[model samples]
Target: MTSQRAPLEPLVPHPRAPVVPQASIIPPPPLPPPAPASGPAPPHVFGLEKSHLLKEALEKAGPVPSGREDVKRLLKLHKDRFRNDLQWILFCAELPSLIQEGPQCGLVALWMASTLLVPPDGVPLDRLLQVALERGYTAQGEMFSVADMGKLAQEVLGCHTELLCGGLGGPNRDYILQHIIAGHPLLVPYDEDFNHEPCQRRGHKAHWAVSAGVLLGVVAVPSLGYAEDPELAGLFHPVPSTPYQPPPLPEEGFSGAIYLLSKQGKSWHYQLWEYGQVQESNLQLTDFAPSRAMDGRAYVVPAGGVRSGLCGQALLLRQHDTSH
Candidate 1:
């Protein structure tokens, strides 16, 4: 038995030949970036979307000119004309500087709206700009379409707003009169210099001004003038020069289309109510003509009565909220 066991042991050197290496695990490839957006972008309500656009525009904008004194003077003039305490409500607590390096008529319009909605403390420029930027009201800092402004009035002010057309000749004067009679100030976009034609040589731009009062059958609009031209700042010496230093008068004659606004039964229309009730006077559009600021240039109004984006033709804004 011992010998058999020894023989069995000797047979086995069969062996430990080779060790195979294991393969390491590999991760899958990274995913590719998302594809670019397709098709036309959806329309956005100004001051409600793409607010960054507003910020960019404000950042690149020129410095605001000093126009407080001008506002004060204008307010006084308005008071003298209206002979009532309501004049204060019509004018901004202080004139705002919207025109810096470029034409910011839309900004001017916002400021005007602030003057009406927030009294004593008018719309702060910084606050307005911040809101506009946050809301995406500005269009690449180039221009704010009239349609966007109407949307702003509704969303920001929580009030009703509308837009009307002036057609090939110009805006309807009667339409403007109706709004003014209704006690709503108008944001009118027009040629800054009606005396001059639209030409490259003039270097002028389309401008926005506020019509807050009526002067002897003419619209009383206070404007920011040459705010971008610091060199011309002196022209407004003592008091800053407003686009309409003397206010647009009927005698001056109009040269461009004017946009208008108002509400049908707003509480603010007490004066209009009085005119209609006591004087029995009609708010006739015939009395108003193309303001001196209009030089037959294209103006904007909301198309189809929808108040959210830009559209074709000159128009008026009419708010019908009776609450004021």
Candidate 2:
């Protein structure tokens, strides 16, 4: 089933991104590139390390986290993978990290991830919303079931999704990473309420995070700036604004850097931080609007790390392999 109603704004798909075959996704065509040297370089160019001076500066730098020191480790992992700084900049630009709208975090994350394939718009948000409403997966806007969400991918986007219960520790958690390392993007759920508890799978109070690639002891989950960016703000609506922007540097870009989405008294802020580290406290989910749909629901609990799901309940999604 396709969504007959269109979004308020037209989605501008990334260049070379192809549409999914199953859904009635009608993403607008990619726009032309800007003129060369027309403006200042992006923040990521300075987020990486391109010189010996930076390496020395990073080593002597204290861990107070001036935001620049945070850049050192991320650069070490991906700097060698790309040919030049410009190429790395382009690669980072293509990565998706849209902000969440209410309890639509799961939907926004899955929708954000759909852009990874060849198409401007991946799976339309309306299509996912429509299917969820029809199939009762929406669960009062909680978008509660990962299994049902996976089915949405199969039915609407023609993707192959797998559910893995990777425990929260060594070895067991490795199972989830194995797929990401194998190039599968993951949609994981973890309760903000149980973030500090190492052994609970309570589906109540959860949020979805998208992981694109993992390697070198770090995972790439691009996020932040979607709702804040002036150009993209219209599409990522109803989101509070943030003034948290990275301090400008030189040419190197931040490869593994992650923007932590947290809330202030009234608005949300994007702190320049890493999500790779295990949590010590709860994330503020008041903005997402709590729905107790996942309460008392049966969910998967995999063995190994003994505390898996620390990265949230892991759900892997990929395009169907049609090469038969």
| Root-mean-square deviation of candidate 2 | 18.0
Query: Relative to the unseen true structure, what is the C-alpha lDDT of residue 66 in candidate 2, on a scale of 0 to 100?
Result: 21
159-200, model 2: which lDDT tens digit per residue? Answer: 766654323223324444444434456665554433222122
Write down the lDDT of every candidate, Cα atoms only. Answer: 0.33, 0.39
RMSD of every candidate to native, in Å, equals: 29.9, 18.0
Error of 1 at 129 (Å): 3.0
Q: Estimate each model's TM-score.
A: 0.37, 0.44
Q: After superposition, which runs of candidate 1 have C-alpha atoms over 4 Å from their true positions? A: 1-101, 139-141, 168-171, 194-204, 217-324
In candidate 1, what are the lDDT values of residues 1-324, reduced to their tens digit? 011101011112222111122222122122223445897532211221224554455446433222333333333444343333211112212222222222344554555455555553345444544454445444222233454555555555544555543221223444444455344666544333232111111112343444443322223234433222233221121124333243242321332112122111101111111111111111111111233125332222222221112212222333444432
The C-alpha stretches of model 2 lying farther than 4 A from their native spots are 1-94, 166-172, 193-204, 215-312, 322-324
Best by the TM-score measure = 2
